[model samples]
Target: MKLRETLEAQEFEPYIHITRGPGDGGHWARQYAHRFDLVLISGGDGTICEVINGLSGTDKPIAIFPSGTENLFAREMGVLPDCDQLIQTLKWGRRVVMDMGQVNHRKFLLLSGVGFDAHVLLELNKFRTGNITHLTYFWPIWRTLWEYRFPPMTVEADGEIIVENARGLMFVSNISRYAVGLRICEQARYDDGLLDICFYHCTHQFRLVKHAWNTVMRTHCRDSMVTYRQAKKIRVTSTEPIPFETDGDPVGNLPAEFSVIPQAVRVILPP
Candidate 1:
């Protein structure tokens, strides 16, 4: 209501549609996909994922208003907190073509993780109730560290074939940062027409601790155990079924094919 009022007061023409239940965002997005010039999403990562899924292949751009606990994608674009400022900025903002990642047919704006990270989200969903909070992920993160077992997977990217035999996490990002401001893929650029892939090949507690420290210091990519690469396409296959999460939502199990849609979607960003 506040956002709507602010936009209306600014004399900016905006359309508002509310969803009734889960997965209703996709339906609402499709309904307005052709009618709007740009779609302003005012919700969490899950909602943004739904909107992207709906607007895939369309030329219309998207502007985001971060209203969720973890607005990972919005944070990357540097969106402001004030709704009025956001509206004013959008008036003069340029639409930049940014890369989007696809797992099978689903689209993701931020990052996707296979193995460890996916297991964490899977566990988190089991305990999530109405209105999720940041604290809601604490237990799951802790449990994932202690009890989670990693699966070995073969990763093929940039003409390099590597088999990771330990319990580890793989991050395929269009943007540099992941959750908690981790620069796992430090050299990544959103509009680079390529995907940055990071693989952590250590499962030992001490090594994981060291990797986490390096991640905090933004030097994780330099670690010998961590392999970083850029590619237009990546294919991962595992002997056991490994679940994967895209833009914070669990999509499906591997073998997963990740590819970059170069300069595919337009987004309103700061000048």
Candidate 2:
């Protein structure tokens, strides 16, 4: 059955809004947010991130319908945009408060990456024409890994210098799992009031390929070249310039600060 039929059968007054382009997530939510008790967004992580940023100062709870290319956040939350499951969540699910990460004033609910992954996102955004799939990443990743220069960066976690002049990849995670089912930061907790930071201290292409395989196997956290920590605040700077991405949307070049807004957004989950 259709979503409207399902919701109507469940006795709910559901509101539907479709986005026209990038950056419309916030607009749609802001324009119609006051008319509803709960806002259910149907998009991938990037679209959800835009909505989160728009809903930063509001009190209404948000739910996801998972309708984009890489639904990383939905995958992490075990949410699928099926009528049965959505109805179940809307009718019987509990509302749990989840933490959102802030980097230079922007909010992200999933994870953020600096260096290689960010470069891939930067390249991917150039060709994103509202349709993206797994195959769309192949060429971008290949080109970035081979041609992108590794910039040295300095990282401070909780006021201590953990990395200085290092050429590696950094992942600040609010969720344990990443894109394509990779658990890069297994220690991440959405309610723990901290961000999980993982550093892959390898710049060579072959080593990164090995690291990718290890991440797929969920063993990257234990590798000797990897450093993992939990912190409420982190500051990152680079000698040149470092690209960064939050929830798969390329944000900007870094000299960035990352911190968590503890228990800010309430999310409805399957009971």
- Considering every candidate listed, which one attains the maximal lDDT? 2
Off by over 4 Å in 2: none
User: What's the lDDT of the predicted structure labeled candidate 2?
Assistant: 0.87
All models: lDDT?
Answer: 0.83, 0.87
Query: Could you give me the TM-score of model 2 versus the true structure?
Result: 0.96
Predicted candidate 1 versus true structure: per-residue lDDT over 18-45, tens digit per residue? 7676779888887677887778888887
Candidate 2 lDDT trough over 10 residues, lowest sum: 1-10
Residues 44-143, candidate 2: write the lDDT tens digits. Answer: 7878888877777788888788988778788878898787889888878878898999999888988899999999988887887758889999989999
Flag regions of model 1 displaced more than 4 Å: 164-167
